[model samples]
Target: MKGPPMPAPLSRREFIATSAAAATLATIPVVHAGGSDLLRVGLIGCGRRGTGAATQALHADRNVRLVAMGDAFEDRLEESLATLLRDKEVADKVDVKKENRFVGFDACEKVLASGVDVVLLTTPPHFRPLHLEAAVKAGKHIFAEKPVAVDAPGVRSVLESCELARKKNLSVVSGLCLRYDWGFRETVKRLHDGAIGKIVALRANDYRGSNWGKARQKGWTDMEYQMRNWYNFTWLSGDFNVEQHVHFLDVCAWVMKDRYPTSAMGLGGRQARTGPEFGHIYDHFSVVYEYDDGTQLISNCRQQPGCKNNISGHVYGAKGH
Candidate 1:
């Protein structure tokens, strides 16, 4: 006789809440826009990245206002709002009220329903697909962080949402900021115009020390703890390759005018990040991405202390270095 299959390790409470929230998400109608007066903005995931995005939005335009804020934790929301208000450029445009500062697993839903024109989704990668879908369904434009998804299923959802956003005339911009830099753009343009002839090989390296990993706080559930320290988890951050190193790899692809890698073979291991707080993510990876024409892209990333770092990308061709 076969024994019972092993159960998932997630907490029952977290599972029930997540399932219930997902089931009810379909009921949120695509409602009114922020109108033509002010470009009202709401921020989800009020962490360091979220605060930075909120400030940059205010500085980018004269007609924008930070109207609402939300986070999984109330303290984070408070800190984010404080930081936003403290910045000279952002303070004048800050208009979030006490009632509009939401916190919890359902905080994103509340922020989306608050009638904002745009939303900044700087949550962990695990929440990107969910938050993006919700933002699209709520009829709001989105500026989401990188590696839009942590898995293939989430990527499928994001691709579907992108099509829907197109139909709805909503803008969905990813925070792959390197693509927007003038210098990188100019170099890529020259490379495309035959400055780099007969491309031979490319290399992308994001070797760096440990990022912002945190030890578990007291009284937090496993799920809650993981969400807080998401960068350490593969399902949350997609490892460092997709989360951080995708930028350099994409630069190589852009220079070659190829949108994707045809094949990839790689291996990775968790070296110094062996503590429980580091979760299940690897500390280093070495992958070779092959194009259809046999060109291969070498990729590597390491997140361990006391190691030499290299956060650069290179393209090699017959005519140039």
Candidate 2:
């Protein structure tokens, strides 16, 4: 279906002004552009990744400011703000008086309502759909991290939100930053130019050390702990396969210029880290995806320390390697 109509493009000056305003409010503490200048930014999650993302966004352009911060945990929000404030570059751009930091489940909405022009959705994959929907409804541009969703339902929601974003003329940049890298872009161009002939098969592997975190304390609700230790939960992380390995999956698809695989089968299970606190996620996974032309794509990923960190993807064509 056709998506919503795109919003009018912002003038260069307007864009700069909005970005600068956002930077001031978010606590980057940089010099303000001028009167009527502001690009307010809101952060939805306050985890390490989320805080890191906020740093990048603030540094992406001088015109942007982080004006609002929100998270379920007050400690996370405070820690993120402190870290941002500690950085001179970020501190100089942030407006201490105007910035509105919030906590609790509904804090996201408060941030949005506080006149943020850009929203950074760094929450867990499971909550991505809800956040995206809210941002789209508010007509705000978004910078959402990878693995947009953890399930079919969430995927459908994001797809719909993408449409709304298009209609609103909003820029929705995914966290698939590799796609923006110079080398990857050049490789994709070459593949599209038939530098790799008609691709027949592919293999990709992401082998690395474990990325496990301590479990939550007793008496915490499932939702609370799940949010804190999100990487360990299937519903929140979509497993290591879709969560971390999806990069390789995306790379293969980009090289082949295809999105859908006819069918997929895989086997995965948690071996080293065995405990109820670990949630339902496999520490190792190997999957085979078949395309319409009978082309096969094999992908394997493992999360165990001491293993080599090798990320390689190969494509086989009719002309042979």
TM-score of each: 0.86, 0.87
Off by over 4 Å in 2: 1-32, 96-99
Q: Candidate 1 on 1-321: residue-level lDDT in tens?
A: 243343343332232223112111112223333545467889999999889888877775566778999899988899888888778866988999988899998999999999897898998888999999999999887788888998999999999998888787776777877776667877887888889798878999998998777899899998889888898888889988888887887788787885677999999998897888788888899999898888878988898999998899999988986
lDDT (Cα atoms) of all candidates against the true structure: 0.80, 0.77
Best by TM-score: 2
221, model 2: CA deviation in Å?
2.8
For model 1 the local lDDT of residue 72 reads: 91
Off by over 4 Å in 1: 1-35
**Residue 273's C-alpha lDDT in candidate 2?**
62
